[model samples]
Target: MPSAPGTGKGGGPDHGYPPVGRLLPVGGGVVHALTTGSGPDVVLLHGASGNLRDFTFDLVGRLARDFRVTAFDRPGLGHSDPLHADGESPAEQAAVLDAAAGMLGLGRAVIVGHSFGGSVAMAWALEHPERVAAVVTLAGATMPWPGDLGPWYRIASTTFGAATVVPLVSGWLPDSYARNSVASIFAPQQPPDGYLEHVGIPLTLRRAAVLRSNVRQVAGLKPHVAAMARRYPGLSIPVEIVHGTADTIVPAAVHAHPMSRLLPNARLTKLPGIGHMPHHVAPDATLAAIRSAAVRAGLN
Candidate 1:
């Protein structure tokens, strides 16, 4: 049974931003999670270089009104302890998060993934179908891209960079640079006022966030995704993919368009002239996609 919505951590130290959610000490390590509202279970996994705050900032609060919202900091991203010091593949992330959800009594929820999180959500749906009621992917990088992720990720993914370079960069990184980066993600559509501050984008520059993000991004992810893509046809659960046509980071034409045809029960929602961060740039459309997935999954 879902309990009434409650807060695990609210704000105190860093002005008004609290990263750690509910810390669950399972077996050995601790898993940080944020849970609220009470209804059909919904688990949110954030993108790369982010934490649960990404959702808690806006979408979770709104979705909580209709669903029990649980957003987790992927290992080493926010307050969650790292399962591996190097990095975790989407499949590995899915395993850890799925087990954590099981411990929380989240028994089969509509899994929503934004950007990098969308990849993990797909992995969960593919590997553990019983625990996933449905799937909603927002600008997910599911299909394999042709080339490398560019200079930054290439250099940062190395062990030497993760240990040395990342910390150095994170320490000297400017907030303005971070803000500009956020703005780029919202290209073709401006980000909502205070969205960057609300999500605590600067936190992504932290040592752990930087290292884990880079390591995961440039760690030859194409092979893994290609393998995952092969298994999509076998996945029978409801899937809703929400993408912006103008997303330069992960183009809908490349990822979402091809994915829609691949999945037997998948629908694509392509927003014209929108950029990468559709959840923030186009929240209503994203919410509608989630609702549609829920209905298709028989959760509504």
Candidate 2:
């Protein structure tokens, strides 16, 4: 278990963004979950360096109008406790979050994941098919890419970086630089107004644990996805893959395109001129994909 909120101790960073819903103690660590609306279950997982707030910013509110939406802060990202000092594998993350969902008494759910969260969603469906009604990946990083993730990720995941560099960067990183980084992620298409404040960039930048965990997870993601991809053909559940043609982070050519072909039952929706944040860039399309997944899974 970790320390309480706002303590800034063994727990996550105290960014003053309190939990909007409840916290669940499962697998010996706490997970933060925001549940809303009422209907068939919908579990949302955000991408790397993001908390549940990513969905709560807009998508979850709209989805809540029709479905019972539960947006969770994946282990170590937000209010949730880190599974371990080393970056947690997607399967490890899925295991802890699934336990949290079970504690909430949620039945089979339409699992929706964004960016890195998409990998976690796939892992969840792979590990606990009985608990997942379907899956939706919004600009998800589902497949292994061909190149490295750059020097930042490479260094951040190292022992020396985690012990010294992470703390140093966290201590002195300027807000402007962080904002610029966010902008770069949404390049070609600017981020929506107030996304930075709403999503809590400080929470991610200021927390050494969060930064270290994120880098480790990202650094180790390619191999994980490669192994996971080998089993995609065996996954028979409905999968709605919503990707952007313009996504540079997880290029559609590298991931979504090949993944659509591999999955036995998958519908790919390619949004033209959209970026990595498809959920935010094109919420209507994202919502439609989720709804489609629900219908295909016999939930609607």
- Whole-model Cα lDDT of every candidate shown, in order: 0.78, 0.88
Q: Look at candidate 2 and tell me the lDDT of residue 109.
A: 96
Residue 296 C-alpha lDDT in model 1: 88
Q: 230-291 in candidate 1: lDDT tens per residue?
A: 99998889999999889998888878999999999998888988888888878899889888
Question: Where's the lowest-lDDT run of ten residues in candidate 1?
Answer: 3-12
In model 2, where do residues sit more than 4 Å from their true spots?
1-3, 8-13
> Using alpha carbons, what is the TM-score of model 2?
0.97
For candidate 2, write residues 117-167 as lDDT tens digits: 999999999998989989999888889888798899888899999999999
Error of 2 at 296 (Å): 0.6
RMSD of each: 4.3, 1.4
The TM-score of candidate 1 is 0.91
How much is 240 displaced in model 2, in angstroms? 0.4
